[model samples]
Target: MKRIVIALALVLCAAQPTLADKVAAPIPIGIAVAQTSNVALFGQEQVNGAKLAEERLNAAGGVNGTKIALVFQDTAGDEAGAVNAFQNLLNRDKVVAIIGPTLSQQAFAANPIADRAKTPVVGPSNTAKGIPEIGEFVGRISAPMTQVAPNSLKQAMKIKPDLKRVAVLYAQNDAFSSSETTTFQDAIKELGLETVTVQKFQTTDTDFTTQVTAVLGANADLVVISGLAADSGNLVKQLRQLGYKGLIVGGNGLNSPNMFPVCGALCNDVLVAQAYSPGAVDKNPVNKDFAAAFEAAYKKGPAQFSAQAYAAVQVVVEALAKIEKETGKKIADFELADLRAALNKSLRTGTYLTPMGEISMAPSGEVQQKDFYVSKIVMNPDGKTGSFVLVSE
Candidate 1:
């Protein structure tokens, strides 16, 4: 009888799951961004940033020794694609939180789904106004256009105090560009500059001859462009080719090195408003480490998109760690729904040292970033390579 009882006890012990099994199971987080289409230029950088965060966090013991797994879903630069990606991450992948859907237009469509599903979302590049107001679960690391869009104009005024006429152009189809242009126009009016013309173009439009002719007709001394990489770069190139020699100020949308290839030699001297700069090595040690890792991986400096995406990942991980410490329970052991709810609450309560500098979230889910920058694109003589040389902060 004793031998039979011992044998049954041993079998029961073997049938139960072990702590090792629980530790081995990674906590899933979703990354939904455009990996295809014209927006890929920005999306690809975001992917690189998030991947680096995953590797670094896992190596350092993620979420109190519970590893994190980043499940990727390509948003493909459209509303429908973003919706599909969010649905898959929420329902199929069962992610705790999500980061992305690159454009504000896509975010408008996709963020609501996550909000309704009670999943937390961090916007890496969706800078349109009212992004955080999408829901209580939605927040962003990217600063609003109100903070970032006016810096370039201020910098331009410093360079040319006599500058008068300003022509504004933007991608009308893009929600970000549309919202950003409003801010730009307000700045122009405040500075008492004449509004020579306002031109609109679709994100898909390649032929900008009509827009270029209108800019020339007005003889605008300064041309401000608010559009994405491909279209904005092409517009800058066309403006230069058609013989407009005045200073060109680009919006936050053109704040990437990807603009170099699109406009070539003409990309030089375009002033861009920036939220992140890899050149700020002396200010923050975290930025120094991030920039080094990025350069090692890509053989080039990181852009704003990369830095913001990395910050988003860091926010999630740190919040989880906080939860684990407060509750004295591993995040992996918490019910998924409970853990996610805790994370949303924690994200709004802390200040983070990110590549963008020290930032904290307002109760409204807006990121209150301390630093903003304006830089001028300095192209090499080869016209194929360039860097954003910081001018003001």
Candidate 2:
């Protein structure tokens, strides 16, 4: 009879789910970004940054020995794709947080899903206006155009003190570019430069002869472009090829090394507003460590996209760690809803020393970054390699 009872108890224990079955060893965090499509140029860098962050954080003991596993979903550069990715992350993978959907346009489309689901999200590269205001659960590491764009214009004006007749160009379909052009236009007016012409293009555009012609016909002294790496770089190439050269100031969208492949030697001396510069690694311990680890892993210098992505992952992990300390329980043990709420609160309460410099979010979910810069692109003699050399103090 005792043997029978023991056998029955063993059977019951086996039938019930085990801890391993209920909770995965490495908790999953969703990384939704463009892995295919034209935006992949920037999205690929964001993927690299998130992967490096995952490995580094895990190596650092991983939120008190609870490892973080990243699950990537490609948004494919469209609003519908971004919405689908966010839905999968929220309903299927059940991630504690999400970091991605690369562009501000995607953020505008997909963030509401996460907001409705009460999931915490961090924008790695969405820099347009009203991003954070989507919801309390939404926050971003990218500073707004207001903080980063004006400095580039100021630097450009200093370079050509009498600069006038501005021709502004942007990717009309992109939320960030469309909004960024308005900021650029405002800055142009504020600086007392004439708005000679405003031209529009799409992110998918390759032939920019019409826009280039307009810029030249207007005889603008400074050309301000607010488009992504590919379109903006091509515009720069066509502008240089057609022989319009006073000063070219690219908005936040052009702050990528990927621009080199499109513009080549023409990338030289282009002024771009930057939120992160590789040289900044020298001043901050966190930046120094991230740069070393990122280079060791990728064999390349980390750009602003990568830096911001890394910072986003760090924000999530750090918040998870804080919850672990406050609750006296492993993060994996917390109820998913409770954890998400706690994370949203934790993300806004502290300052982080990131590769982008010291960053803290305002109550409204805006990132209050301490450093903003304007860098001039210096293309290699080979014409296919380049870097942003910081020019503004």
C-alpha RMSD by candidate, in order: 9.0, 8.0
Candidate 1's residue-wise lDDT over 208-318, tens digit each? 999999999999999999998889999999999999999999998788777899999999999988889888778789999999999998898888889999999998989
Which model scores highest in lDDT? 1
Alpha-carbon local distance difference test for all models: 0.90, 0.88
**Can you write out model 2's per-residue Cα lDDT over 1-393, one digit (the tens) per residue?**
999999999888764422322234588889999999988988999999999999999999888888999999999989999999999988778888899879888999999999988888899898878899999989999998978888999998898898878999999987788988999898888878799999999999999999999999999999999998888999999999999977999987798787999999999999999898877755688989999888899999898889899999998888788878877888767777877888888888878888888898877788999988789999989999988898964
Per-prediction TM-score to the true structure, in the order listed: 0.87, 0.86
Assess the local accuracy of residue 16 in candidate 2 as a C-alpha lDDT between 0 and 100. 48
Candidate 1 CA-lDDT value: 0.90
Instruction: Name the best candidate (by TM-score).
Output: 1
Superposed by TM-score, candidate 2 places the C-alpha of residue 69 at a distance from the truth, in angstroms, of: 1.9
